[model samples]
Target: MRMHRIGAAMAAFATFAVFTLATAGAALADTAVKFALDWKFEGPSAPYFVAIDKGYYKAEGLDVTVDTGPGSVAGIGRVAAGTYPLGFFDINSLVKFRDQNPDKAVKAVLMVYDRPPFAIVTVARTGIAKPKDLEGRILGAPAPDGAYAQWKAFVKENGIDAAKVTIENVGFPVREPMLANGDVDAITGFSFSSYFNLQLRGVKPEDIKVMLMADYGLVLYGNAIMVNPEFAAANPEVVARFVRATIKGMQDTVKDPDSAIDSVMKRNETADRATELARLKMAIRDNIATPWVMANGFGAVDPARLAASIDQIAVTYEFTNRPKPEDVFTAEYLPAAADRMLK
Candidate 1:
């Protein structure tokens, strides 16, 4: 009996030692990841803030820091240079990068906003009813890439002479005022944001005309989460967990948009509460809850849709060097939470 007691004690000690070592190893493996956002903290990126506020990243055993950068291209470039482990950017811009440097390996792991939000917003009094009306009108454009390319494609596809429309790089902040003061007859606006800002400024829905790019067959993916190809290959488990947590965040935002708005507002130091709230609500309704996103599962990308976008890019922008559709994005990392919700 004495011998058996001594053996049992030894076994218990060994088990405890093993358990402690395993726990320590896991703690050590939990790494910190830095994420760069393509733009300032706003509605479009509320889900990321929601995830952070709700401790989603912590739950995944990750220490995440989300920072805003100058633009999408800069964000992607930093990630490629290993300065940022992850980033959120325009899908079209990523494609442009691949076209410019085929040797640089990068891939978008998940698409946050499934639909493109680019639109042409004109005051109701302007009577710019269709794409054709854009002719001879001064229009505000963001820049010479990504959405601008799509805008130019829309003009050409519709038989509107690009020269007839004067393009000005008005930047995102001044787009609304430019239209209001008649500095530009129309401006490129995110369907959700510009619509809400105009309403808050006393422009009624009926008094405004919006030409959505998606309606003109310019259905491209925007605001995708991308990773370095090496990182993705070596740390798929970490990538998978991050994607899962992000999808859960998006679902939570959709279910309670008002609360999500508050969560996002808390992260913005210089954010105007009224304007941000309006933009958040509008983005949820017009951009997030659209048929395309609803049918395919939020943040889900269909290969066919991606192929169409790639084809459009090649034809429209002379991007003969674009990456193959399969290399651009992968749906494997998208959370099963969206699937569970579908049921």
Candidate 2:
């Protein structure tokens, strides 16, 4: 009887030890992924922060660390260099990069800014109302700005003489201030960014004239989730999980943008909730939630539209080598269309 009792106790002890180890292993198995964001902690970046704060990333077993980036276009290099496995950037920049450096190119998985906020903002007081108005005027653009990168295309599309406009290389910090002070006749920036910043600086909303490039036939995609092909190829399942988690975060953001801004505030102590909330709402109405996104789905693009954008880009971006459609983006990592429905 004594021997039997000892044997039973040992068996129970072994089972408990095995269970504990198994649980620990599962907890430790989360894949760590580094994501390079287009800019600092801002309202538009709330969804990503929402993912991390709400445990959506953890639900996908992804330990995603979101890092602040210099600009929308620079995140491409960061991902291609393998410093970050994934990043958010303008798809137009990706197309150009794929043409320039085929071997080190990145591909987009999720389209975040479907409406493409590329725009030229000017106050009505400057007498700049149309794309043609930009000619013979002083224009400020940050060298690394996504809107500025497409200036050639904008100039060509609207039949404006590039030589007629005085181009000033304004720092990001001074792009709006220069325009606000009448130093520059116009500036290239994201539609919402320019509008809100100008408003905060005492410019009347009615005086702000925003020319969204997409409304004028740019037809380009804005920022998207891109990945280093090598990293994606090695961990296809992990990539899929990340997309799923991001979709959940985006859905939540659409439901409550203010809450999403809260997540960003936790990361950036100086972020004003009211201002960020306004920015977040504008992004959702203008860029993220759109008629196309509603009719089709989020995170996916119409192939025909993407093809035409590549051709438009070719008009101004003299590529050393032509980039193929598949090289710039792929829908392989996107969740199902049903899963992406924001409504």
Candidate 3:
């Protein structure tokens, strides 16, 4: 009886050891990828976290770590420097960055914001109602702000006299406060960001005006997922898997923003649940699910539209050598349209 018991115990131990080794081997097979985001842990960033928490990335044999960035423009540099294999940033900034570097292999892969969130936020008391109202008014704009980068283009498009407007170089933290305290008559930022932030600061909803740049003839795409060309070339499957997982996250976000905010709150402890939820929903309704994206599909851009946007960008930015749309973006890694369409 003792000998039989000993033999059974050894067999059980061997089976357990084999199972543990196989599990560890499978875990080791997963490719580790670090993802960079344009801004802090906020409503719009929830989808990526959702993908991580729900095991969407793991299912694709990827281990992705998402980190917050300083601003939309910073992610461009991060990806180009090979600090992160993938990042979300302003495509317009990426265009200009490529125009200057001409050597960096950073290219936008997924178009997240079909319509740019760039906007000029103001209050009714400021008497700034239209683009022309900005003239002679104090405008608080962060030097590195993605929206402010488009000011030149916006001014040219709307025929606003740029020289007449006094732009104050405010930090991102101070941009909204300056406007709320009446320190500056207007501020340039993302529509959803500035709008909600101002409301949180006691600024009434009816009083604020968000003049979205896209609404004012600035034909531009917003933030997109970018990748280092070398990394992408070496791991095309990994890139494809990353895109697929991200799109799955986006779909979940669009369908139930309320549930999505849970993911953001998990990362951002100080964030107001209601405020972040509102911001996430606004981003989805305004930027992510635009008519074009709804009709065509997500994660891709129209060639003609992208071409027009490039031409519009040239109005403010002088490029030494312009590049074709294909030079900056690719649909090579994107999943099929049927798979990407957000229902």
| Whole-model lDDT per candidate | 0.78, 0.89, 0.91
The digit string of per-residue lDDT tens for model 1 on 91-111 reads: 887887888878877889888
- Across residues 1-343, which tens digit of lDDT does each residue of candidate 2 receive? 9999999999999999999999999877889999989888889998888988889999888899999997888778989988898999889889999888888858999999997899999997888878998878999998878888888888888999999999999998898888999999999999888998998888998999989998887988889999998898899998899988998899899889977889989988886788888889989998998889877778998888898899888876787877877888899998889999976
Cα displacement (angstroms), candidate 3, residue 88, comes to 0.6
Ranking by lDDT: 3, 2, 1
Question: CA lDDT of 178 in candidate 2?
Answer: 88
Q: Estimate each model's TM-score.
A: 0.85, 0.92, 0.91
- In Å, residue 76's CA in model 3 sits off its true spot by 1.4
User: Least lDDT summed over 10 consecutive residues: which range in candidate 2?
Assistant: 315-324
Candidate with more favorable, higher TM-score: 1 or 3: 3
lDDT of 3 by residue, 113-165 (tens): 99999999999898888999899999999988889988888998888999999
TM-score of 2: 0.92
Clashing pairs in 1: none
Query: By lDDT, who's the top model here?
Result: 3
Off by over 4 Å in 2: 1-24
Superposed model 3: Cα runs more than 4 Å off: 1-28
Single out the weakest 10-residue window by summed lDDT for candidate 1: 334-343
